[model samples]
Target chain A: MSALAEILFGGLFQGSLYAMMAVGLALVWTTIGVFNFSHGVFMMLGAYIAWQLVELGLPAAVAFPIAVVVMAGVGWILQASVVRPLIGRPNIVLVVVITTLAAGSLIENGALTIWGPRSKQIPALIDGNTTIGGVGVSLHQIAIIVITPLILAALWMFLNRTRLGLALRAVAQNEDASHLVGLNVTALYGLAFAIAASLAGLAGIFMGGYRFMSPVMGSDPLLKALIVVVFGGISSISGPIFAAYLIGFFEAACSYYFGLYWTPALLFGVLILTLMVRPEGIFASRSRGLA
Target chain B: MNPILTVEGITAGYGRVTVLHDISLEAGRFGNVGLFGPNGHGKTTLLRAISGLLQAKSGRIQFDGQDISGLSARAIVGTGLIHVPQGNRLFPDLSIADCMALGAYSPRARPHEAENREKVVKLFPKLAERWRQRVRTLSGGERQMVSIGTALMSHPRLLILDEPTLGLAPKIKDELCASVMDISRGGVPLIVVEQDIEFLLELTQQLYLVNHGAVATEIKPGESLDHGEIMSMYFGH
Candidate 1:
């Protein structure tokens, strides 16, 4: 039925956004050995930046890219000031968790204060809807579905083919050896954060195109991204991506059949079962491999 | 002429536990030196400090006439000191070919990437056959070959190997020793640490006995004592 296609397409569309956020989360986790708790806030900030730019009369095309660039800078700054300082300490992991969690809270509260908690939305990049097989679909949804895979492929190529990406992978695998092999590891860490932020920012822009985004809108997606990253192996880029879409489809199906209210419970139940069976992860590699 | 690399009265260690105490050693312009000692006696720590993974708390390190006591590990590697650390510590997920490319990541080594890669493949032809294999899948000896080959791709002016043949079958160890000899014959200097006195005697011109985190004795391997005598000397038997 066309209704089936609609759900599938809807799942794929939402899955694309989840993939973007989770991939970034996974990259930062592997690189810095710290799970950036502010990752979701970065998404919220990106949507806000794009909204502000559009408010200043910049078109969606210009605003989205500018927001991504700005988010890259913000990511680098976050790593430098917030993350980099705490590396090599005795209790770095614990310290970083607390610090980043506090930083996320501060940024969220600050955004709330500045943006006034008003729900804002960006006009869709292309303002049109079309029916395919008697199921109505928005053009932006199709665009998101098409665009995400290409971006992920580009990322894969960068990681597997380029020398810089090789260095990032190397750092993730054995940081000491990466430095011993003459990599500028600090710079690579900064790059990982920057790239992750850009990806998260794009996800935010895509989200704003479809739904009203408030400062707190990121928390839900953040939780979803966490699930995706865990479901996928955090050690590799492609793992989180596949898991993201799979989770997205699961969410859609559960919402449709089990009712929206029961979706969360079912998701958590399945996640718990999956973990109980395979505590490492669903896509876990035997050894850490960033690519 | 000044020695190629010199450590003058260096004191270094991990956090709060001092290991190398007032250790001083030097390598000639174009000769291999060996260090042998009991386990946990600071040979690896000395290599770590010399390679810039650890800082000398109370002395100076000069490499090719440049003062390099407190330089970062990357900087030291850029200065053409390549260390293939102990225990095949490598990025297990990377393919052998990828490891070779990454070894030449420093600007100083980039220019020589092509020839160095050729040399590594030629030195360890087994590595060439499994260019796309992940390091984790490789056998122990094969991983060691990849580690050393990866180091060779760095165009090292000075190559340091910590227990290059620590654990392997005798036949594989022989092949590795021959390959290392070939590397040395090709004119790259070596600072090797090993437990096999026969291997050390064959490889190094001079040997330093490290004990209690200091150089306890310096002996020319082919000079006065036999290999058994030297082993006893190192073990303090």
Candidate 2:
């Protein structure tokens, strides 16, 4: 494959994964009215679970759904137990900090207990190289690229067209009014968290198959997702996706020309620039910050 | 005529500070009442308390004779007590049509969404004209219409409008008053909270003069309460 094609294909595949990963974080942030720091841990848990299941002789297809479902269940339970009790409280920062501390400790210790410190490779769902338009791409990478978009399309439909989707959107837009109209706001919060966790779970499995899984592998993806959310603007569904692809392509180009080590610097620079130019993210039209 | 909605001794407040103290009122079948008070005296808070947006420290709210005191905002709204809250709380990102659809968000109202939407559109032709337009892009008056139209979609037996004319022009306020009169005539009881005495007197037959969250006085239409009494009651001498 030509260098340019490699960059394009690599960027696209990675961007899709990044977008999916960050979407979960974004949903939790917007819907639950909390900056949950434990979101990345959920992703890690998914990867770890998928790795274990694959080790037990389960097929990749079965293992993936199982991981997502587990993570979603965890998400629901967490919201019910920890997040729900703190609703209407003014201590948002405390909740966020606690989530972060709890998540980091849990992930690091949980990984040590279950999967050990050693990194594990996931057998690729599809192997070998595939060529498209004179560009060579790995079949595994192509599968991820294809799957991510399809998942996103389904999510878009779920949020926009379904009954719960409308109610969820209403709750996100105006919490008090949604309650006034008789929506179960607490239930909506749980669903939002579950959806987010499921996305992270999906990302974890995808990452495990494409690369390698470790106890602390979630940090990079979580940070990248945060960047994508910031770049796309908070609360915008399409914004993060577009920004994800852009960042992915940018990272690939930087890695190719300047070496892989320079990618982080480039991403941080882009993030800083975005913050300077548009604090609300490139997609936010009006100020949505709570007064 | 049977009372469709009743508020009995509802002592409500924010947190520990009491705003409304032992206040009570009612809306009869096909009735319209004006709740008048000065700023910060619990006019809006009463509406909030009754609509289940704010929990009363002690009280009973009977909507269709069912106790709604401890009910969730959703349940209160489900019992045909819809509150068009202060400020035009339109879902700015959603279109006018979507906002209207969300009005009937309860399970019972969900099935008749299409029919209710048709009636709402007919009532507010301006909304029909801008059905697809996002609510955030709408003018103040247009957004108010969308807000009211959304409440109407729920097919509420009692509509609680809190300061609907807060920031509108005189002509727009007049138009809004006319809309309220129309809604009242259409058989939905209205409890309109307004500072404009003329606006209230022109449309409503009964008045609850709220002072410090308590019903200080009740005035019936055709009563010879002069403007002096109204001014003192509104301004709180």
Candidate 3:
């Protein structure tokens, strides 16, 4: 029972982090119709920037925010220069896919050149652990658990309570209608990309403290986020969060009972079965009301 | 009287396929103009050009005495020319209330959102009754009301409606046309592109007959020609 509890708690913390990452990807996907292959690279960039700032004697509080802001600026520039120009052009999807995949490669190689191949360790924001139900959890794990919900709550508020947020939703639904109704579709696209990148940055900062950072660390999280979004449904914001936890627990259970190697097989099996059975996803039957 | 909108020699199209050629028209303040033509001509294209959805290849569009040619659809909305596009392009998943609020998204309309919302609700009481329902759940005519109601939330000075009566029952169409007449009578200038000639004749002060991407003729209300005669002239027997 104690072992079971430990595994479940660990899964919950990891799942929350994946949820943060997946939610951002889902946002950009639903809004802009681009898969954003470079999403993970943004996360890597965030972690490295945060680490460099902390190394330069900046506090974790200031370092993380600066990283997030930098990621947002990167997002804006990427959208304006790369994505916006390709819009309404022939073969846009193919063009964007190639462009973003190339961007990911560039960012990954750039990080390797700058930071080298050695893994960087970031100090935890809060040190110590707490025990619950005969299982011990680190403060970093607790922070991951708490911070994800706070971010989601803030995101919900932004989408529901703000005009720009509503406009974003409008654009996601129908670009032509959004334009006809006086929405600056290009600006909304830029803003959505920025917001999505900022979320990735925040996730990276948290994960950097919780685990070792590497130039390629973002690839795993990126794959997990993609799986979560695919499993949850493309258009839903909350759906991916729910799917993230499910995948997390399943992976944890698989690793505990069988082995770490069996976890990937099970995850892929589930994804294949889901695609065969319900391509629209479990939660997609309900209209994506306001995400 | 100074016309609120003057479009002259405007040519526009979608990606090398020119749909409008030398299209010229004008609408005065508090006046309604109708564009009547067969499908696949230039009625919808011209409206798209005037609303700034499609760019003009040449010539000019002046709105409120300011040159507005080649401006973005978003900027044109700021000038108080709201377009309720065809197929009732309401965000199907959104509540009617949210849809209406989103219509007032332009900076110029933000201050008057609440008041304009009230006016729209009053204009289409059916929409008010189903304010919380998603737009997709509404009937075709009800969705039309929400579509126009959404446009009205922007407090448009010149309202352009495209095929508002499409796919609606005749009873509902009559009710919507009556509501539109009431709106036009309340002094909002209107440019309506529709296939219902009788409805256009009843609702519009003047009508322009379009063919082959150009305005071929202009006719006033109470013209000697009846609906059948106008139809024969426009569509041919």
Candidate 4:
């Protein structure tokens, strides 16, 4: 019983981080219609930025927001330079592939240029441990779990209630229609990309404190985010958040009962099954509304 | 009356395939001009050219006595030329309010977003009723209303509607046509493209009959031909 509780707690906490990481990739894909490969690199870049701030003796709270801002700026620059020119071009597959390759190259080269191939661990923001139903849990881990859902709720409100959010949703649905409605589509695209990068930066910040930072740290979150986005539905924001929780819990259970190797296998197995059964995704059925 | 829009020797195409050849039309504020032709006759293409969705290979377009041939689609939209594109092109996954809000996407429309939104909901009261409802859930006619209302948000000087009544029931078509008339009456120059000459003949003053990417004739409907003759002319013998 204690073991189950421990596993569930751990999984849910890890999944929250996954949700943050995936949000950016899903956003870029939905709004801009580009599966930005550079999404993971953005995460890496964010983590590094936060880590550097810490090295500069800045507090974690200040560093985190600054990292997000920097990442957003980076995202804007990337979209302006690389993504804008390719808009309305029919070759979406090539664009996606190019972005993915570009991201990977950034990661490999960036690590060498900046961090010098060394893995760095961040000092946990919330140190010490707590017990949940007689199961030991770190305060930092619990904070991560609580914070993920909080961010999700905030994001939900932001998208539904804000003018900018509504515009982004419109662009995601139909770029041409958004344009006809007098939307500055280019600006909207830049804004969406920025939001995505900010999310990635936040995720990276958490990743650093939770474990360690390195160029290779990006792949784990990226893969997890990919799964969450697919599981949630490419078009739905709420779907990804829910999918993250589910995947997180599942991963926790599998890792506890089986082993580390069985975790990926089980996740992949479930992902495959879900893909075969509901390719549009689990949340997609309920979200059949307009763009 | 001063011409609100003037197209002189405008030629346009997608890729190497030319769709409009020397196609030109002129209109004044409150004027409703109908482009009557069969499918593939370049009516939509001409509107697209005017809207800057497609560039004119060789031509000049003057809107309100200013050359606007070099503007991008976004820029042209900013100049009060709102295009309600063919096919119920609403963002299917978005809500009614969001769909209507998109009409205020240009800089000129931003300041009047609140006023325009109120006007849009008032015009299509169905949209106001289902303001929170997703666009995909609306009936085809409701979606059409939203589309028209969306275009109107820009306070358009010139409104170009492509196949406004396409795939609609006869009753719905009548309602849409009435709305178009109402919009034109409100001091916006309207260019309507329709396959049905009878509909245009009833709704508009001047008609341009297009054939093989060129204007076959520019005439008044009630004068030179009856409804049957106009149909035969557009559809051919």
Candidate 5:
């Protein structure tokens, strides 16, 4: 019973991180019609920025938020300079893949060149451990479990309730219609990237507090996030959030039973089977959308 | 009286194939104008050029005396020129209420959102009952109402509608025609492109027959909306 509880707890914690990472990827994809390959690097870069801020003797709270803010700026620039120019060009889908992939590669190398290859950890929001329902878990894990939903709820409200959020969704649904409705489509696209990047940054901080982070630590999480997004459905914002928890639990069960080496294989197999069964998505319907 | 919008010798197209060749027309401040033509000729293309959705490869467009050829579609909308394009191009997942909010997104329109929304609801009373319903659940007629209602939320000085009644039931088309007539009676000028010739004639005072990407004919006042004459005048030339 205790082992089962622990496994479930681990899944929940892991899923929170995946949800944070995947939503950004999904937002950019739905809004701009391009997959941002640099999203992983945004995570690594965010963690590094937080670490540097902490090293410079700032409080973790201040440093963490500052890092997320910086990532937002970086994301805005990425859209303006890289993504915006490529829009309206023929074969933009293929071209964006190459450009963002190259941009991610460059940023990854820049992190390595500047921060060195040594894995580093940031101070956790809480320094102690706690027992929850017969499972031993870090308070940081508890923090993640608790905080992620609030952030997600905030995001949900922003997308559904606020005027700007509604406008962002309008852009996602029909770009030309959005323009006709008087939305600044370019600015909204940039806003989507910025929000996605900031979420990735916060997820990075959460991961860095628990596990060590290096210039390349973003890869594993990135791959998982991509799977979660594809598995859930890229059409609606809620789809990936729902899938992340399912995958998180699935991964936990696999880790406990089949072991670590088998988790990826099992996850990939499940993804393939899911795709074969429902090519549209696990949760998306035609009427469901980001707006 | 001065024209509200003027397009002078504008030529635009998609890519290398020019869809609108040297198309020019003027819209008066007091009366609605209708553009009619065969499918795939240039009626919709001309609307696209006027609204700043397509940049003219050459020539100028002026709206309310502000040379607006350089403005983007969104910027053009700030001047209260709203386009409710064909097919009720609303986000399917968005609720009617949310759609209305997005319709008034610009600074120029936001201030009048409350007042304009009242007028829109008055124009389409069914919309008030279906406020929380997503656009996907709306019927063809209801979607058209939301499309026009959303445009009205922008507080348009001059409204442009492309095929607002296409693919609707005859009953629904009559309902929409009544609402559109009320809209014109409310004093906002309209640029309507519709396949329903009777609807076009009843709604607009000035008529232009667009053919092969140019203004092939312009029927001034004293011209009757005689179906036979219009058919021959448009098809004969």
Candidate 6:
């Protein structure tokens, strides 16, 4: 029972991180129609930036926000310079996908060149562990568990209650209608990318302390994010959150009972089965059109 | 008085396929004009061009004395020209209230959003009742109401509606036309592209017949429309 409890808690913590990572991809995909193959690179960059800042003597708390801000700026510039030009052009999907993939390669190579291939450890924001129901949990895990809800709540408020967030949602629904209604579509797209990048950056910063950081660490999270978003329903914000938790719990349970090697097979199998059964996602509202 | 909008020899189209050729028209303040023609004769294309969805290959489109030929759809809406597109191009999963709120997205329209919402709700009380409902679930007539109501939320100076009554029952169509006439009477000019000739004649003071991507004729107010002649023209008989 204690072992089960520990796995459940760990799973929840990991799921929340996946939620944070996936939400950005979902937002960008639904709004901008860009799959953003480069999103993982942004996450990697965030981890690196936070790590470098800590190396320069800044505290983890300060380094995290700074990295997020930098990532937001990077997102804005990338969308404006690369993605905006290709919008409304013929074969836009092909162009954007190729451009973003190229950008990801460039970022990865740049990181490799600068930081070398060596892996680095990030100092934890907190030290010590607490016992819950006879299971020991690290302070970092607890922080992640607590912080994820706060972030989700903040994001929910921003999306539903704020004007800019409302505009972003509107654009996501129908770009043409948004423009006819007088929304600055270009600015909204840029804002969406910036927000998405910042969220990914936040996840990266948190994970930097949670686990060892490497130049290629982003690929796994990126794949997990894609899975969560697809399984959750691309159009629904809360859907990915729900799916992330499910995947996280399933993986944890599988790893605990079976083995770590079986976890990937089980996860992918579940994803495939879910896609076949409910392509719109487990949490997706039936009324929502294609994302 | 200067016209609220003027299109002087505007030529526009999709890439390599000219849908409108040298289209010129003008609308006075609070004037209601109807574009009457068969389907695929560029009536919708003309509306799209005026709303800045399609770029003009040549000529000028002036709105309220400002040259707005090259302005984007977003900028055009800022000038108080709102287009309620055909086929109910609404966000299917969004609540009717959210759809209405999004209509007031421009900075210029934001201040008047509440008042406009009130006006729209009053105009279409059905929409008010289903404010929380997703647009996809609404009936055709209800969706049309939402589309028009959404456009009204923008506080438009010139409202362009494309086939607003399409796929609606006769009774609902009559009510919608009445509401549209009410809207026009409330000091907003309208350029409507509709297939219902009786509704068009009842609602508009002037009509333009477009054919082969050009303005073929203008039927002035008080002139009798030769129904057979118009039918033959539309059917290419």
Off by over 4 Å in 2: A131-136, A287-291, B221-224
Fnat, model by model in order, equals 0.85, 0.75, 0.77, 0.65, 0.83, 0.79
Q: Against the hidden reference, what TM-scores do the models get?
A: 0.97, 0.94, 0.97, 0.94, 0.98, 0.96
**Ranking by lDDT, best first?**
5, 1, 3, 6, 2, 4
Best by DockQ: 1
DockQ score for candidate 2: 0.63
TM-score of chain A of each: 0.97, 0.93, 0.95, 0.94, 0.98, 0.95
lDDT of 4 at B183: 74
lDDT of 6 by residue, A63-167 (tens): 888999999998888899889999989888789989998888898999999998998877765778889989987898788888888998798898887777877
DockQ of each: 0.85, 0.63, 0.76, 0.62, 0.84, 0.72
Q: Which ranking of candidates, highest DockQ first?
A: 1, 5, 3, 6, 2, 4
The lDDT of model 5 is: 0.90
Give the per-residue lDDT digits (tens) of candidate 4, residues B1-237: 677888898999998899988887786533578888878878888888888777899999998887889787788888898889999867887777776666776778889889878767666677788888877889898988888888888778888888989999998888778777777676777888887677777767788888999989788534656877777777688
Model 3 DockQ (Cα-based): 0.76
lDDT digits (tens) for residues A84-181 of candidate 5? 99999999989998998888899899999999999999999888997877888899999999999899989999988889989888888888789899
The digit string of per-residue lDDT tens for model 1 on B35-64 reads 998999999999999988888788999999
Q: List the residue pairs that clash in candidate 3.
A: none
User: lDDT per residue, candidate 1, A1-291, as tens digits?
Assistant: 775776797689879999999999889888778888888989998989999999999988898999999999989998898889889997887888788778878888988998888789997867899987777888988889899999999998998899999999999999878888999999999999999989988899889999999988889999999888777778787888999999999988888777899988988887787778876578888566687
Lowest lDDT block of 10, candidate 3 chain B = B220-229
**Residues A1-291 of candidate 2: C-alpha lDDT, one tens digit per residue:** 578887998799889889988777667766766766777778788888888898899998898798899989988887787788878877865876696558567766878787788888776768798788688677888888898999988887887887678777777788877777788899999998899889987888888876777888888888898898888887667777788898899988999899998889989999999999997888766633210
Model 5 pairs whose backbones collide: none
Where model 4 places Cα greater than 4 Å from the true spot, the runs are: A286-291, B111-118, B220-224
lDDT by residue (tens digit), candidate 4, A1-291: 898787788778878888887777777777887777777778888888888888999998888788889989988988887788877678965886696668567765876687877888766768899899889878888787888788877877877777778888887888777767767789988988898888887887777887768887777778888888788776777777778888998898888889888899888888888899998888876432212
Compose the digit string of candidate 3's lDDT tens values, residues B36-141: 8888998888888888888889989999999999899999999999889999867887889888889888889989999988888788988878989988889999
